[model samples]
Target: MYTISDYLLDLLNYLNVKDVLGVPGDYNLSFLDHITRRSDMKWRGNMNELNAAYMADGYARQNGMAVLVTTFGVGELSAVNGLSGSQAEKVPVLEIVGTPTLAAQYDQKLIHHSLGDGNFEHFQNVHKELGFKVEAITKDDAISEINQVVKYVYENKQPGYLALPVDLTEMPVNPIFKQLIPSLFRNKNEPHDHLQNIEAISNQLKNSHHPILIIGEDVQRFHLQDVVRNFIINNDIPFADMIESKGIIDETLPQFIGTYNGSLSKDLTNQLINKSDLILLLGAILTDANTGGFTQSFNSQNTIDINAKRINFYSKIINYNEQNGFVNLIKIISQTSLSQSFPKGPHDSINNKLPVPSDKPITQDFYTSAMSNFIQSDDTVIAEQGTSLFALEQIKFPANVKFICQPLWSSIGFSFPATLGSQLANPKRRNVLSIGEGSLLMTIQEMGFAVKYDLKPIIFVIDNHGYSVERVIHGMHEPYNDVPALNYSLIPEAFGAKKNQYNYFDVRTEKELLMAMKSIENNSSQLSIVRVSMAASDAPEDLKEFGKIIAKQNKG
Candidate 1:
């Protein structure tokens, strides 16, 4: 009685996917029934395919892997935006599109979701451009194709798309229990080669008087926290992160310097980073956002940048083949001893403490500091790509926490849907989302899914009456940058929240915000949403600088 659908669910379960995020479509109804009825996989229906894809992305980031199922054509196209964000962020999400039957395809019949031109492979070809390993699955190679796709996703930390035909759902297939290792990473399991390169790096660190390290997002992707922590603590090297990799290292550590966003960093941070003798840049994603619009300055000759697949030491580029990767490189770097010590940032500095509440309106400065205290250890903080992210850069997170954002992709409404995925991935942890009103307007429907599932995530909606980020970048007084005023506190109720299930607050002043924070603390078991109103003209200093830089670049 076992079917291919059952086998597919089993494989997903093997990959530690307990729930699937997607919307049900008629084309995929048969497979949806199998998922909804199955005990191994729980189906969480989203309001739309885009939100489903974003939720799956958030889940993948937290759980290491995730799945998104959608109907072919329209559903698949709608979910592509989310999948593209995941692909850009290097998250592993398996995208399954339940397509028309093989018979329909063979006969070149026009389907409801098709283009009517009798071309079945057009969508798959379109997906190929988005960095997805796309495959149109058939009965004969279904199991093998699934296995291969899953492995590619896990090993490469990228999205994979599979167009699953409806007719193959009932076909019996053996569930492969093989691990999904990266097929393209030939050097993943290989031993270290070029001991000379290791020697050169070790000697460089040992001889340097002030060798500093820079941590980045790949450390979290590769799960190298312990190795990174030990390397920093054992060698007494000061470390800083690019904005995208904010919480990759233990921020509470004494040796942890603040994040560097090129010229956007504070004066002290910029000085220290630029003055480094030997800079060991590990797992960095050097995007314009991460580099503060390409303003970050480092001596190329003094920098040794090591990523998952390659090493850039000085002017030389050594690619990882069947010999070396981060595994071997990290080992060599960890064992090396520095000859001299570098001055670390103040260890006893409690500069980021929350401010005492007053009757004044809640400014971005005050809100950032207050939130530092509101956030607890082990909480996952998700910020939208604008003012929320820029303000949070000033706060120092506690231990065992996560910070999720799409700085490079710059998606506006990603945080709200991502919160659902993050909470589902780590149900026990407290999940908090910080997003502006404009961004929230895009994916607010996903809140209904949260209420239906009884999931709790503290959400902060910064109400500035419009697109605050856009206004700063350009068109400060323009109508296009202004969003309709929303009563954000009513969102949960509108989304069908039960009585006392969620605590809602609307705070315009510092005193009100402080009271709201206390209320949220007391109602930890319930979902909470706080709406804080700020001046439409106000923005973080760093954001203003970024806007100017971006505006200037656009003009040139």
Candidate 2:
């Protein structure tokens, strides 16, 4: 007769989980001890539970399956913030919460730190807001319950949960669970009139000019990137992505029009999409923020949406499952195709050409060059928000290169630990992150993880001061983005980074930037933070009119 904890271990193996991200405390020591000894599952070290959750979110976004573990109360709550961020972004994360063992949960007297009745009702109920499936695991139901949880999270593309009481962590395996095998399918929720909407969308596409296409993160989840890219290329439509939709096309493609959201250009793309008689929005949801609150930017004759859910658009709502309701529409477009005017290879179009390297003082183009010069085609790109966002928007990704950016939530300080997880996920791939100095301090301790394991990634800190996005939008733009610049070169020595394994440099001009980058090549096991100055500037177009109207109304 195996104990409950042992059965839980077997269940994790069944689900093929290789690592769990979280921190260990006294409450979870036994459980951590059990998993730590097992070769099959390893613990991803975390400096903070919040970053751990973000790391799990990134890992989920990357590997499609991410599991996070944390202690009860504060630990679990620390992780909820990131979990919520993940849920909002539609990333799937499995949160394994360690509860106070049943043997000690009854607080006969005042406990060291109990948030509630020790039942963790608040903890479990929090998922209702987070929109993820939550379950409390008992010693007896370890295998069956855990298996079911894993299957649901995988199918739904949302976070999953397993609340572990300390007692269950060390319990033996369940004999009955050994016979259980979980199915990976999710319960389908069909829209009321899905097929009719598809028919209507087909009617719209059949009568159009300049019919462009877009595929979002959902396509990536379905492993349909190749399918969608082929369809777009065959149709010869210039394409763009929501932040999460990077890599759907070779971003380097001539026909690929980059992302179409905050900080992304709305110039030619906005004009083309608005001018298009038909827009086929496949896998892309019409989120207000993504579409500037679905404002006047959309002037197309018809907007046909294909998504995981039936979304109302152009008086028609379409919901399709794996092209089940979409085949009829595809066939119609397959017949009246006119994309042959577009070429197969990359762009020769002058408007779409990469911006010429300019000496223009303080532009995203400047930092993009600094990064591109250092970034080997073989290296992976891990981007953070703010100036890093600006820099990467223009950087062309290389072959065998994967770019990691948390653009969905665009949460600050996101790239630090996420880079750590990326390194762990693919050891051979080098890590590089561009972060705002203020954002980096949110969880600067994560750099310690690099020190502990000596997992070196070249870190470029865009020391553009505090909250660049906020200042530009609301308050004074300049002086506001300014924060004290620390000599980041001492980071290696301060963090116990391997001796001679790291270097630090600051760059404000063209020559110094080039020299610093040249020094980093062939370096190993090092943390290099290249500090780039931040000069305040306006967004592509200020929303002053929009902001003014709202403010005036609020005052009224």
Name the best candidate (by TM-score).
1
Give the per-residue lDDT of model 2 (tens digit) for 461-511: 766556665554456456655556666767667777766666778776656
TM per candidate comes to 0.95, 0.83
Tens digit of lDDT per residue, candidate 1, span 449-498?
99999999999999998998899889999999988887666778888997
| Residue 378, candidate 2: C-alpha displacement in angstroms | 6.1
- Name the lDDT value of residue 457 in candidate 1: 93
Clash count per candidate: 0, 10
Compared with the true structure, all predictions reach lDDT values of 0.84, 0.64
lDDT of 2: 0.64
Q: What's the C-alpha lDDT at position 58 in model 2?
A: 65
Candidate 2 — which residues are off by over 4 angstroms? 1-16, 103-110, 116-119, 175-207, 262-266, 292-296, 299-301, 311-313, 318-363, 372-379, 394-401, 477-484, 522-525, 536-556
Q: For residue 418, what is the lDDT in candidate 2?
A: 80
Query: lDDT score, residue 414, model 1?
Result: 91
Question: What are the runs in model 1 whose C-alpha is more than 4 Å off?
Answer: 175-189, 347-351
